[model samples]
Target: MRDIQHIEIPGHTLSVRVDPGPEREGRPALWPSVGEYPIYDPFLYTTMTTDDERNHRFRAALAHLAPDRRILDIGTGQDLLWAREGVQAGARHAVAIEVIEDAFHKAAANLPALESPDRITLLLGESTRLRFAPRADVCVAEIIGSLAGAEGAAAVLADARTRLLEPGGLVIPHRAVTLAAAVRLSDLLPEQPVAFAEAALPYLRSIFGWHGSPFDVRLRVENPPADALLSEGAPIEVLDFNGDLQTQQRTTTHLAITRSGLVDGVLTWLNLWCLPDEEPLDALSMKTNWATIYLPLFDSPVPVETGDVLELTFAAALSDDRVHPDYQLQAVLRTADGQQRRGSLISPHHGGAFRSHSLYRDLFPAG
Candidate 1:
């Protein structure tokens, strides 16, 4: 690899490198194209064809359009398929907005000869807050993340709807469905058996009178679409899956423990994509740009019993590598004895050095 120095924040020097590409601003290009990690735009993370569900949703959103309908593509990447499809469905103009300078140029260069050069227009700006002289009849924004909370999708959609859309205009990616469930914490890592000695030994003496190691439950899910964003305190239900399914886009839900045992940690997973039909979404059938962002719910010793309800408040937000781009776990466990314990884990990052501060506080809170 060639050695290339780069700058992140303007007027500041940072140790970063640009991939093989034309230089932009003050630094070399980040990647040769847009599919690499540390990508400027999240949309580049996914292949256009694999997102059939969202593509279908976007197409359906424009099906009712009449000729000459003006549409705005918020967070539009190098691909202008939505605009082209919208035009084919009667939309007259497609205006695109992007924040990354490199992606902005890419979109301009790539979208010009798409369906019609005169029909598409690309601009550079923030999607969360944008201004346009000509209002749009339809707005298409695909700013979803691994958990429906990255890239400020909520703010961007809300702002675009309020400031840029015409009344009765439709938005693409019609609806996103989020589901949730309760499974034994141990079920998440069936491939790796945990050591009873290493996991259970330290919790013998605790304020909760926990005699054994706290058992951790894991909940795996798929990334969600922007339309069906998950929030803290959202209500959810555990639906039945045929065991043939592998991934899901679940929301905050309550888990009832069937046995009395120590409660330790939680693992969360996400899946994001659109399905054309009820083909049963799962890990085997889907490919995502983002990997699983797991957060441990607790690091202390706790206990639970049959019928104990773990109330969860799941939320997703935009973040960087410095911090997780989205959050997936928020739970409050209600024991059979009427005790309330926080179920959201604050352990260190996975495979990284474990930070004992939060775990220590959880295990032994200051009196």
Candidate 2:
């Protein structure tokens, strides 16, 4: 097979990506994070269900807290995962909420098969919109996004805190943070234009069509290379679901350039603590279902040396849909020579600019 493969879109022409580095070998399989989009299928759910690291930690937390407590499971999916697990873990009862119609129907079907099905209450609606009678003693959810709060965990859980859960109630996956570091795209792979694996094409088409047009969709790199980071990762956004949870927040963080290299963008990933005392499951280090996302800031890569400091301001707020958060990042690079360069990025979980950036333009060439 040729090193690069030419593909076709209805009104656009896609050319072959040039040779990437020899060590990289193949195109990285790419997928847009569909969680916030409310698109549920076995494709996404299977990953989480099979994620032993995620499951083990959550189960451990539930076993320690769910016994004899009234539990609430948000986004329980087709399998009613946490709700069923909660009942088995000795919870008095579990209320399972799912918004996706098909998944909710399947969850309804899955309910009667579980032992003591009456112990779980099934609700087919958004947790924020539905009313709870007596409130819950614990709440469990797996609504985490690739960017941590990108799925609106801060807002959704904050609502639970006010209405659905008891005061100081336990929230599984206690805290999550979005981590960022400087990375050179070429160094991450080869110098060639990036390519999507064959499996990613259908999902790409679906996503573009889902948005009614193509946009600068977030890129999810599967199994990122270990040596891609040029600076130590720093927390850009923090979501303490159990503590002072804020739906909208703007934070500025610093990353000291540890290695001299061309900085293309910030490579961000997730680090999650399922319980207060648990070790965080790191997306960058652990082989979990969570993938890393590359937020391209510079249309043209910037040159930097060791000792350079990158001051980054990251912002997140509700998008138009009001369920997911839109992300904006502004980065300023300050060098020892008093030279400074700036770059910025806007990645909305929903409707935004179409093929405006260089990367999107390259990926979806005009007719």
Candidate 3:
């Protein structure tokens, strides 16, 4: 069977892996929805706007709490959905913040066209940097990244609590946590070489372009196999948006192997709750825009049977911009053979090293 396939058309030529099996088999492909680069695109906005799960939870929370209260909507995006929705829900007034200028301008131009536009205030700047008076009674920000706080939600929300919101004010998406587990990459894709789908190439280039170079940007896999997981997932990073929230964190968790298999990496996903008492939306189990992330640890596969232990160390810290996070993952696999296999990955939000790893090397081939 062919491991790879080439397809050519008039304007473009492409070579892609022949998916080992049908879609149910979980052939991994690169997708652009997971990262938080603050770049605005039409399709990306469409995904967020159309996500009924996200919309229902957020709208319900807003409708319930935003009434008769001033609202603060950070990263309001171009649609101004939350800000407008908050007003529609009976908010006294809503302050909408957008970091991307184009989006902010688009929102600025459109806010006036909507009903009760006079009650919405639009700002063009980072919510963390911009200051406003008479704090709101509710802060609604859907900036939670695929990896939870990967979008600077912790830092941004923490700042909101202290400066943007009134004391004891409500925060939408009350909590978010990152879950991780040991996985055998080959099981996810039998003998396929890791590569981006043709549709993903443009966005891949955009991510690299935004970062100034391909410096190990976070990789999100679409349609990962349920059986690919070698161990039960455990929470590695937890961000309590309405409570104690920190910008930097280091967490170590042990995942016990549940089956006999080879190990090479950890798969991580986000669990988020719009309110304290609500059920969380799990990325691994649900069909949200947030895709599960593959944090590759080992290049060479390590043999492991049931009862092996993989200790994973995950760290998230603010980069220079202080608006996005840089993530580092370290794994130590302890098996029955009395030997250990160790691997680590340093993923920065922006430039650190160009094409630093094998996956990246293949993503951006030699020119």
Q: Per-prediction TM-score, please?
A: 0.57, 0.92, 0.90
lDDT of 3 by residue, 209-260 (tens): 5655445667778778788999989999999988888899999999999998
What tens-digit string does per-residue lDDT give for candidate 2 at 69-177?
Answer: 9999999999999999889999999999999999999889888889989999999999889897789999999999878998879888998889999888878879999
Best by TM-score: 2
- Candidate 1: where is the Cα deviation over 4 Å? 1-43, 46-49, 65-67, 177-253, 257-292, 300-306, 315-330, 336-340, 345-367
Give the alpha-carbon lDDT of every model.
0.45, 0.82, 0.81
**TM-score of model 1 relative to the true fold?**
0.57
lDDT of 1 by residue, 13-35 (tens): 22222223323332211111111
In candidate 1, where is summed lDDT lowest over 10 consecutive residues?
Answer: 28-37
Cα lDDT for residue 117, candidate 1: 70
Cα lDDT over the full model 1:
0.45
Of models 1 and 2, which has the larger lDDT?
2
- Candidate 2, residue 342: Cα displacement in angstroms equals 0.6
